[model samples]
Target: MATAKTEKLSASLEDYLEAIYNLSVDGSVARSKNIAQALEVSRASVTGALRILAEKQLVNYKPYGYITLTKQGCIEAQRVVRKHNIIEKFFVDVLGVEHTVAQKAACEAEHAFGPQIVEKLLCFIEFVNSYNKNGYDLHDEFRSFFRKHGSIAAGDSN
Candidate 1:
């Protein structure tokens, strides 16, 4: 399900798109200064990225003005966001990672995997959730097994 926009989006561009999408989640205009703050990048950098995105028809960018995604842009942004969320959930729920750690790791991973992997991951997460609801308690079982066989030094509960 990869689109032209998605296929050509570099990791840095994807980050900017994700930031803009998150900033404008409530239908507000995403200003360049705001985008700079959100991404911790310079306003010049944001502008450059916005230019590329605009050329790709992913964003409607005007000089020194607020930014907004086109319909195709929004769809691509949502796909990226969904991948990030799925990876984060897998880290937290299945791997027992800390919330912050999971979020950071997912941020890195979101750009690596493609739509097919992300869709499969979503299904795996749903299956695990349903399995847990059916009293499988897979998380606890993993924790128990890890505690018994984990290679970390003694007295480490993580």
Candidate 2:
């Protein structure tokens, strides 16, 4: 289920939050220019987004000043980041997806998935990890099977 706070945020806003969170991870406050570069948006766009986030109480923003997430913003940003990482992990580890492709896909999918689907994905990933720990690499087996069969046709029993 999505929280009311996150529900009110657009995908663009979420992206801004994610970018700011990542930029600030090195213990430095994020700058508007850095945010614009990270998102590949214009400085004007970044300013607009920062203002909106500030109004939502998700960030502390001031003109020509560094930006930082509020406590609630950090919580929301962590949620978004967690969903992205979990999706990326599942895509790469379970589906045998290439890392770059999975990263791009995760970025797009994170904004759309709710907590329930994300939780299920995490469970599935954990299940796969357990199999690996038990000396059965399900991902490797799947990759080998795919390589051998290419694409199995419907109703084909080979």
34-101: candidate 1 lDDT, tens digit per residue:
88998898989998999999988899988966689989889888988888999999999987777987
- Cα displacement (angstroms), candidate 1, residue 23, comes to 0.5
**TM-score for each candidate, following the candidate numbering:** 0.86, 0.87
Q: Single out the weakest 10-residue window by summed lDDT for candidate 2.
A: 149-158
Q: In model 2, where do residues sit more than 4 Å from their true spots? A: 1-7, 132-135, 151-158
Best by TM-score: 2
- Per-model RMSD to reference: 4.0, 5.9
Error (Å) of candidate 1 at residue 24 is 0.6
lDDT per residue, candidate 2, 32-85, as tens digits? 999999989999999999999988889988888779999999998999989999
lDDT of all predictions, in order shown? 0.85, 0.88
TM-score of 2: 0.87
Candidate 2 clashing pairs, residues 3+ apart or interchain: none
